[model samples]
Target: MLDLVKLSGQIPGLTQHLHQESKASQERLRRALQVFGRLQQEPQVWQSRHVDWGSHLSFTCASPAEPLENSRPKIEPLKGRHTVVATDGSQIVPNHHEIAYCSLINVGRVVLHYGTQQWPLLDSLPVLLYPSVELQQNSGLDAEEVLALRRAQAEVEELAQLALSVPRRRTTLALVDGSLIPWGLEPLSGQEQRLWLNPLLAALERLRAARIPLVGYISVSRSSETVNYLRLGLCPFLSCECYRYCNSDQAPPCQTFAPLPDRVFWGSLLQPGERSPIWRSGAKVLNPFGEHHIHCCYLNVSEGSVGEAEIARLEFPAWVAADEELLKRALAGVLSQVQKGFGYPVALAEAHHLAVVRGGDRQRFFALIEQELIRAGLRNVAVSPKEAQKRGGIA
Candidate 1:
């Protein structure tokens, strides 16, 4: 009967589909409830390998660089600067006097552009607000985080509108702070994860179709592919060990594949799978407490300040590490360079919300980007924060 009713909406009831839908709710809801119960035995992991303590990329200023006193490789401004959009997002948590209210915070917004970085001013930095309206909010996140995300999105929307309102600069790149795809998209069959990744996946397909050349910066992502391999061992259903099912959704009537595109799945070998090494130029190995070793991706995100004597690059959380001090420093470094470079740096933090580091995996380091501009196929797929050590972008 329900199928009959749905079929009616698809056919003759086209104009009154709403009426048909309302009439069929009870029956459909009943079936959906039964399906949910049947599915309860499924393993539940509140965590998809991606969940972990968020870290920051930090830096301390050295000294300001001398103004370009004379002629020194002054390439003409990026010709017809199309758009080099680099986005980043920071979640503001609610920690107060009495209780650090257990509230999650999120700020998912993207920044817009229309100018060269050499002279980034209010007029140059534009924002893109409403275009993201259809995205599903991760209300699953802490309530405060959801609110913060909405607030931040609203702010950027206003900024984009305002930027469009006035005279503009030659905008080109759109720097999204996070991943090329949204958080929960891949591993599409996972219960909780899908709720997040679905919309993000849609947005990514749209952008990719547009050929926007989007860069997904996963400063501190645990390769979901690797994490799953480590945790569940094989395809949740088949449990095969032959490196198959690389792209199947979690709870599924799954299929198998081999050697999926690097863009489609993160390198599983470096950590568990064959990880990509696009950031080799900026990699650095760290003995954080001077003994226990860790490899990380260090990008000279910005020349916070420079002198012939010293160069300061803001570093941010690139991996899930054990030390709090290290994480704090990294986060501080990335944010510090804003005043010296351009006001848009913080704006750079808004565009990316999900942290999927696929397609030439990279950490957020503007300097690293500058370094890899020449290498063949410089971009990597699912770069690990550990790769920071491999990157030559050492402090």
Candidate 2:
């Protein structure tokens, strides 16, 4: 049902554009490498000093040691009977023309028992939001905003379940598939933040109170937090004001580091089962967390050649970062899952598998909804013509 003829004509032009951009990026990376080498020779005292770049720019940088030069720490083995749990969410956005004005969120969670005879458990929980004045109005939220709220709620609920299920004596590592920071709150109004972020923060507090180690795993991350540190060292201007207000026309010296992603730098450095040094996250979105600001580190999960290894970013709260033993155990649990998955975390993979809703599943769900509407005396229920046409396909 695809237009192969049309796609074939477009493929060559797309490929050519990508090739050109790749060449340009390579040249930029070369210049960045030159600056990085020079910055590496600076004294630790100079590198550690904080630079004020105004309120908008983050002053955070990598640890003083050359990230690449540091040797990988040995992977710690799972000591005793431990449990690892991960949660992922999927959603069905509200359809305006449907008989019922509602949306659905399904959260899938997996609890894996390591070094024990207990069987692994996998399950899902679904939440349905019905039409109401408060639910609909919510300060005139858009569709994306509504979805974001549901996602945050789903994650919070699943985490609460994990917190309640795990025993006090067991060493538990609770994982979320992505950043713990509520990034969706960045563009919204203050009221929206209170509505969404509060619940997630409350859930985090519960996990912390339970003394469970929680981690956010980001696979194939393109973050440049480390690269930003290298850029700070390359700033030639003596006055913080000059660098703070510098624009493209003024062209600060660190512009050469533009396209370098953090993964590229760490992938070259870390070996299998190794993790980079933890650094405090400077994401402005983290301001809401206050005393529990997020910290991040990179882990090389691949078993292949160093150049080809997959690097993942792991994020945790300040509490976990402060406790060395808890951090080590969490990292060990992640590495164990990654080894079983061959590159990714098996618990996360299983959670996603349980959470995803396919096209066939959607069709059956709607068909059942239609039947229910008919049985309730609202006969001749049907989808919008556009939706019908999409399902029927083109001849």
Candidate 3:
């Protein structure tokens, strides 16, 4: 069915293109490293500088000083009585060829109680979109916006469910697989804030009221918040005027620094069982949260004689970050979980397993929709002709 010979012919050029880009990136990295080292010594000069760089810069670096060492920090072992829960979500976008006029969001959740040896609990929730007349009429919204809303709703619902299900007496730690900050909300308008921000904030508040220690774990992150801080420090002029004179071209002060990711710097500094110092995220979008703003740190979760150590970015709310005991417990719980999954948290892996919607599932779902429509006495409850031809394999 496929031509392997023709596909194989494109490999050489693609390889060459990648090689050239990689070579250029390496050079840029080298230059960035030099600037990073220089800023490390003069931390005070840049520490107090304030810049309103607008929506493009989502986070600020509160602590530019080198990350603290945790060589022998108290790492509490999991009591085995505690509860670990994780949540993940998947979605199906509306397709024009399908008979249905709606989309779907499915959230998968897993709860694991260690030491008891009991089977882990699993659940999947499905939600129908555009169920109301008002919602269906708002067709001006793009696919990205619809998908984002679905994802946000799924996350909030999962968190709310966890709060209600887990008992207050039990020590519970909740893990979300990605950033706590909702994506694409940095430049939020008044309307968007009311529609999106309020719901997420309410969910977060509910979780906090329940006293559950929640953490967002990002594996292999490429965020450069720290690196950008260093860049700001390198600029001699004030934040407002610096951009006018220092453009990021092939020459000048901007070119001296490489576009190194924050992980690269932390990976070199952190040893196994250690975590970098906590840094407050200066994401202006989080300003509305007041005491519940986000903070982050880098953690090295590797064990044994692994060739390359595993590093992850751990993000938590300000309340959790401020408390040393809570932070340590979260780190220990995460480390224990990671050990079981071989560098990943087991709870998250199970949640993702339950959330994924396969191709066969999609086909069956559409078939069921068509059947229901026909049963409702609707005429022509069939897929578009073009879609039918494709499905029938006419070539």
TM-scores, all candidates, are 0.28, 0.88, 0.87
User: Could you give candidate 3's per-residue lDDT for residues 69-155 as a string of tens digits?
Assistant: 335463544676888988888878877788876777778888888767667789878776756442333545566465766676677
> Which candidate, 2 or 3, has the higher lDDT?
2
Pairs that collide, model 3: 32-258, 60-282
Off by over 4 Å in 1: 1-80, 91-171, 179-195, 220-395
After the best TM-score superposition of candidate 1, give how far the Cα of residue 119 lies from its true spot, in angstroms: 9.2
**What do the candidate models score in CA lDDT, each in turn?**
0.31, 0.74, 0.71
Candidates 1 and 2 compared: the better one by lDDT is: 2
- Model 2: runs farther than 4 Å from truth? 16-34, 37-40, 43-51, 58-69, 77-79, 132-141, 239-244, 248-253
| lDDT score of residue 246 within candidate 1 | 43
Q: What is the alpha-carbon lDDT of model 2 when measured against the actual structure?
A: 0.74
Candidate 1 accuracy as TM-score: 0.28
Give the clash count for model 1: 85
Tens-digit lDDT string for candidate 2 (23-55): 886676676666556655654523544434523
lDDT of 1 by residue, 1-395 (tens): 15887676577556578677645643443433333233233323212211221011111101111221112221122233333334334433332221112222233333333334553332222222222222224334544444444443433333333324323433222333433222222222355444443444444343333333223334434332211212231225333332343433453221222212222232211221111222111111221112212222222232232211111112221221233333333323233323323532444543333322323432233234335553545454233455445554665
Mark the regions of model 3 whose C-alpha exceeds 4 Å error after superposition.
13-33, 51-79, 117-119, 132-141, 238-243, 247-252, 304-307
